[model samples]
Target: MSAKKRERPPVPEILPAPVVDSHTHLDACGAETAADVAVLLDRAESAGVTRVVTVADDIESAKWVVDASTWDSRVFAAVAVHPTRTKDFDDAQRSGVERLARAERVVAVGETGLDYYWDYSPPDAQQDAFRWHIDLAKRVGKPLMIHDRDAHEDVLRILEEEGAPDDVVFHCFSGDAEMARRCVDAGYVLSFAGTVTFKNASTLRESARFVPRGQFLVETDAPFLTPHPFRGAPNEPYCTAYTVRNLADLREEPVEMIANAVRETAERVFRLPTVTRG
Candidate 1:
């Protein structure tokens, strides 16, 4: 005899709502097709990630990022030479970045800066490339996005010596309280990412506590550092919610306050107009 199948209990949704992913790499996300971007964006939007700033590490990637930004209003662009790719900054490279900076979608000049941890490029070369990007940011009147890894001293020194533009963003900030204090005092926006959610990310959390509202932001740096619950999995813009949550908890603020601060900081530094909230 066939018995009626019993209905399963409905499971409640557990994922957080969307927030802005201030830094990511859409082109480098390894998405295979237009449908891929569509799927990614859908997940992000559903998770509360309303916007993303896709960073380009080289001229070619920068062009792709800019093009993608044009096609998707929710995405923006940041162009630069990563410390690991300092050798790529030749004449043509410089010209390409300059042209892209003038593009309507190019909002900042980075994920550029020092990376002593990798040392893929000589320290001198990294410094030179960083200086070049900083100069270009000033020339183009755009904010400077930085990537410092085990090279905080050099990064801070260079920025100070070069008179870095007023709009400076220390993306994926992992420095300690002192560096955070210094950066905040210097008017630099500290952009926390998934690393802030790691069990051993006390230093980063402390730094986040020191950064005040209107002077802090958050990012996913997708395809990397997928936060705590999702660690070891591929990260996406939607995962920025974990970072925002961790930051809010660390700063003793409400989740909405954290989101508002991050949104404000991004708009101020990138010169983006106020976002339309739903």
Candidate 2:
């Protein structure tokens, strides 16, 4: 057996307009310290990605995002136990997450939803946690960022049954055009990642085309899902430009247009903070 080869594409030119990475994992990206975070964010800023919403897939990550958001004006936080890890969700963990979710800079409740692809946890447990997170988001009056994988039907069903939060985002959207239309009709925002740029992702590209400019967002989901020509490479927020540019090309729209749309949508949904202190 041999190790699979990965490509590391050079960073593309900076985007013309600033954009935001709606779903990324700062800690997983190896930005464990404020200094490391600053360096990563600086590279992203130089590439015109001025803001980011770091998401937590577990409790420790949830805590980290909350603390990191306070350190960097450009960072916002989204906290939740991911679907695969929802097996660990309990009263104590929920209480901690709830306390942090109400923190000044925590903007959304998520990276939570259903993932049938990986059976790390049983289906019912995942659903239970998903529903709980939904309730928490509604009560807190914050947007919900969903992580739907091979379980789209169940994910949507749960949302409908629970009366989804006022603002819902499908981070790293992985559905076909029809699902995209449904999400748009239901007022859910779809966040695109580098996967949309892959050759085999025609359905994703179609879904992107079907999305109205204001209803879609762009993200890096960094430390994973690197864009085409660079797929399999370690990802970072600075690589957001590549995904944004590819999205623009896919939609046959100007790069600046896509950038501005995502940036504005992110600000509205996540209530981004100023990148500099007043």
Candidate 3:
């Protein structure tokens, strides 16, 4: 059987405390309609994931994200052009993204940073776009969600040069303990994804533990980075439970404690309503 179509994982036990998925791409997870969003949110709430921040990677995606946010009160939106797509970013797209950033439902300016791993975009263009996005983030008074990949040094240098937004988050942080500490020291939030659950990610697990409780966040980054035991299968927001559990075990804290901490952090970072759903 093809791994991409691997057997769907059974829902894990419900969490004792509700949590938030700080970052997820519902559009990429095949949620194109209200029905699809309903099914995904139902499974997520069943697993105790009460709210989610869905992000867009391009102009059209920004539209999808805003529309999805309107489809359900549980969903919020983050809009920006991904670094890889910034190579073709034009004046029109820039203005459009700025407009979306001001949308009442939009809560963040990001998924923007440099990606040296993929040559899809030139470095210079990526840097230019990164600076512009950084400015937009500060101007909008929203947290900046960064997508750093194989360009940590450059990302940090650029952020330092451009002056980071008041709220900066390293989404799906893949840095070592040292980098994690630096981020925490700078008051930046470190969001962990399912990769922290991989057996081979000892450094990542160590870094996850090193991050302070209030600075920690859990995410699915879904339809990708499926946690171990379901590593090769596509992921959904409900699967954030597995990553949160793994993080709790790593930090040597009770699952509820860690889940609640992350839930609170996500709410503060994204300005989400901390609701206790029935």
Candidate 4:
């Protein structure tokens, strides 16, 4: 007999207030068409995740995310060639990402930075791509959403060398308290993913706890990093609720306060318009 399929985690209770998933990959989560995207967003909305910024990690996904943003009023897009995929990031790819970055629905230039954890791309190439993206974000006057993984030093160095953009977000921030302090001091927002709720993530939890309300945001980074208890389960934007609650409990703050803080920070950083739910 075939092995039984694992079930998806049930959606957590609705948040006290709506929150935004700062980064996710709807395409990777099996969303192909507008209807498919809507289905995912519907589930998220029911759990009070009223808005999302779907990020692209490659040229094709860059185009898809821009198009997907138009499919739903609550969806936004962030475009860039992820560091791991930057091994062959030529002029054509850069231009393609640039065009998509200017899309009305595209709010940021990101998921770009060094990922030393994965040996998919060399350090020089990743740094080169990271610098280019930083410049692109500056030229476009949009926030830069970074994906630093085991490469915090080089990522920070490159951003400084490139004269860093006005707004920067460390998506799925994995650094400890000291790094968090550095990022916050530099005025860069740290967007926490489900990983922060992991039982063994004490350092990460410390970072999360100390980040001021306006300096932090929340995300699902879905189809990956499902919050604790559902750690390995299929994740989606709706799972953001669980992370929010966990963050509140960890920070010793009220759920509504955490929800409102992240929502406000997301709107300001992404320049998203206020969303209303019936």
lDDT of each: 0.81, 0.89, 0.91, 0.93
Structure candidate 3, residue pairs in collision = none
Decoy 1 TM-score against native: 0.91
Taking the tens digit of each residue's C-alpha lDDT, what string does model 1 give over 113-148?
A: 999888679999899999999999999999999999
lDDT of 4 at 17: 92
Candidate 1 CA-lDDT value: 0.81
Candidate 2, run of 10 with poorest lDDT: 1-10
Clashing pairs in 4: none
**Candidate 3 lDDT trough over 10 residues, lowest sum:** 1-10
Which number leads on lDDT?
4
Query: Model 3, 150: alpha-carbon shift in Å?
Result: 0.5
Q: CA lDDT of 259 in candidate 1?
A: 78
Candidate 2 per-residue lDDT, tens place, 52-97, comes to 8999988899999999998888888999999999787889989988
Per-residue accuracy of model 4 over 45-109 as CA lDDT, tens digit each: 99999999999999999999999999999899999999999999999999999999999999999
Show the lowest summed lDDT stretch of 10 residues, model 1: 1-10
For model 3, the stretches where C-alpha displacement exceeds 4 angstroms are 1-5
Per-model TM against the reference? 0.91, 0.95, 0.97, 0.97
Q: What is the lDDT of residue 91 in candidate 3?
A: 97
Point out the higher-scoring one by lDDT: 3 or 4.
4
